[model samples]
Target: MFKSLWLQTAYSRDPYPALDQDVTCDICIIGGGLAGIANAYYLAKEGKDVILVEKDTILAGATGNSTGKLTAQHDFVYAKLLKQFGLDQAKLYYGVNEQAIEFARSFAKEGEIKAADSILYSQTKHGTELLRHEMRAYETLGIPGELGKNSELPIHIDATLTMPNESQIHPVRFGQHLAQLAVEAGARIYEHSDVVLMDLKKRLLAMKSGHEIQFTELILCTHYPIEALRGLQVMKLAVDRSYIVAAEGNMPLQGQYISVDSPKRSIRTAQFDDKTFFLLSGESHTAGAESNTEVHYKRLNTDVQELYHLDTLTNRWSAQDPQTPDLIPYAGIISSSMPYVYLSTGNRKWGLSNSLANARIISDLIVGRDNNASQLYAPDRTGFGSFLLQALKISGLVVTEFTGGHLTRTNAPICTHMGCRTRWNEGDETWDCPCHGSRFRKDGSVLEGPATKPLNLK
Candidate 1:
């Protein structure tokens, strides 16, 4: 039940070996998901010496478990972005994401990419108002979109905003293809190479397997930065977990659909093994905030059975996304002082397009090309009032977590990222940190970070 539908595909690849000895490269990418793979693809093609390392198999992380919707219509975001970033920047944001979709089309294999209109519908009055505002933003931005009163979905709706030129893809398969292209272009990729320590001053990465990587440039695409940077990154980002389930059904929608109302729903369909599976996803919560995570899956199951009468569930999985204070990603050089280090994080659950955008921004910076988005997504961009409010909210969460962590008298080990106590997640069977979203397996090895060290369980 916890399997990912994308990982169930017949796509396969031979495992890359771990680093056997100390090595050196011009650039080292610290994760093997879409961002890292895409970055390596661009850089290596331009003749840069690149090496990518992953703690697990390629696409076995959030990329593999993603819902795979590739579109610029990130649910009612245009209106908010228009207000926050102004007209020109808002237009650029939409343009870059659209270009990202085209980037995938450039190399996508047949059947791996599918054309679909992305529809955002609303069942409530407030949601309908949001759609109306978003449609105006779309027009102002010169994006191709339309507002309507109806959709193909079985559920009732007050209004629908349909955006054309959107797409969906088998994300894992496409990522695997990107990895192959990167390797063919002279990028080295390694699997099972868990980086447990980093020496920023020495430009060295130490692996748990006792091998080391020395690099001139480094990119951390590990979803969360391995280092807290004095809690600056953690302060600007919050981790969200969302559940997804694939059920046996006919294709119910010609385009992907998401709701703007409460209990937001995301719907899309895929064809594989001569069968169509409807992927239903929603019920997002902050990671480690819920004690019994199984309830989320159960709720989705109940809703699907009631709505579509889809009694057979084929696969279920969940993914954690790093959300930013301003909803824009943190990309490009980490700081003006440390120009050699780059990072891309905080996609806020829209990684498919954002990942490519990050790759382009970072690659352009490294190759000395002018990119307008560099300023838009810089890691140090701050001082907006709304962004400050969101950052303060995350800070409040941190303080509350610290106070609660000490009050809870349990034998559970403290999180290595911060001192927050670990909470057992029954659905995923991992110990999750509420403060900074580090996860560990039952035996207490690091499953995800900002926590590099395994639990000090005796």
Candidate 2:
């Protein structure tokens, strides 16, 4: 299961009982993260008999490990989107993100910051200029923001872009709250129920426990949508893993700060046990690309010390998010192969806002209602240029890794997704796929996946 600062800070509860008998429901939601919980809330509120199943416990994956920032300011992403997709697309993306924050605020904890401004500061001249361009995009989209020099920071900032009315929440607390709220609304939740196979025609979900769930509808809100079937999600997604270190320090900063330069350093403060913490997160790379992922954590610690003068490092954790070729999250029908199945994934480190929006879009689709957000987030939408670029990059890596493994590997663990050789993640003690971000424990048990099965240990 997943554990992080949020989970450590929040108390753990007994696992929900595994589904021991057959369950027939109006809707069966898979995955226990933000999207599943949110979907459960919406469906349960509509008075549907919703049965949500989790492979692990609730808040035991990305949601438990996240640095929650409910913001549309996705690291100057609007600037690029504005230039590439035009004003209308950018505005819609921004509006949907804001709408998510509004949804969270309605149920978020008292300490959570609702509509707090998010700031992105640049240390270099080139990055500063990029921030300026981003500020212009913000204005064009009618997004409230300001451009200035933030001198109050422990570090120097040449230029900064402030995104007005963003928000933050304690991720675990919020997730737990949602799960409880959903249950109170008559939703049934089951933990330790890993789905091994899905038969679309039969409308049956076969579990690892040998129990079956029959549902009229299914939603794969799992962080990495479980591909018991060959959905070919590997081609559509790229995984980016980033490190996070949470520590209590003497220095405290104001608004949320994200860097506009490489080796991203996103800074935000959180309060736990009456002490505020400086959560420094950055150093992202494709999962398993680095031979020694631990170095990234050490680098972040040193950077935090040098920049914030923080000497105490309490917690160290990592989380992975996926990117689609077009840079837009996929939220709609899972695939034509399984038209009855729907999913919401590829949060790309912005699950806080995107998951809620995706949940809304999926909930509406299940009810067969016209969702205004459907067009932009269609799972089948293709950007040929982006698709080709991603395909070429991924193909190169897969070919090289497999080709090299053939010469030296005698039974080294191989990725189950497409048979690419797995690389050891030194820090996490898991094998990770460079091709598609599938992860396995040293014993070959699946940790995360597009590959639903464990690696053959022979």
Q: Give the per-residue lDDT of model 1 (tens digit) for 278-332.
A: 9999999998888799999999999889887898899999899898888899888
Clashing pairs in 1: none
Q: In lDDT terms, how accurate is model 1? A: 0.88
Candidate 1 displacement at residue 160 in angstroms: 0.7
- Local lDDT at 143 for model 1: 89
Residue 385, model 1, lDDT: 75
lDDT of 2 by residue, 335-428 (tens): 7776668878888899988999998988888888887777788776655574687756765776777788656664668788778788888878
Q: State the lDDT at 91 in candidate 2.
A: 89
Which candidate tops lDDT?
Answer: 1
What total of clashing residue pairs does each candidate reach?
A: 0, 0
TM-score against native, each model: 0.97, 0.94
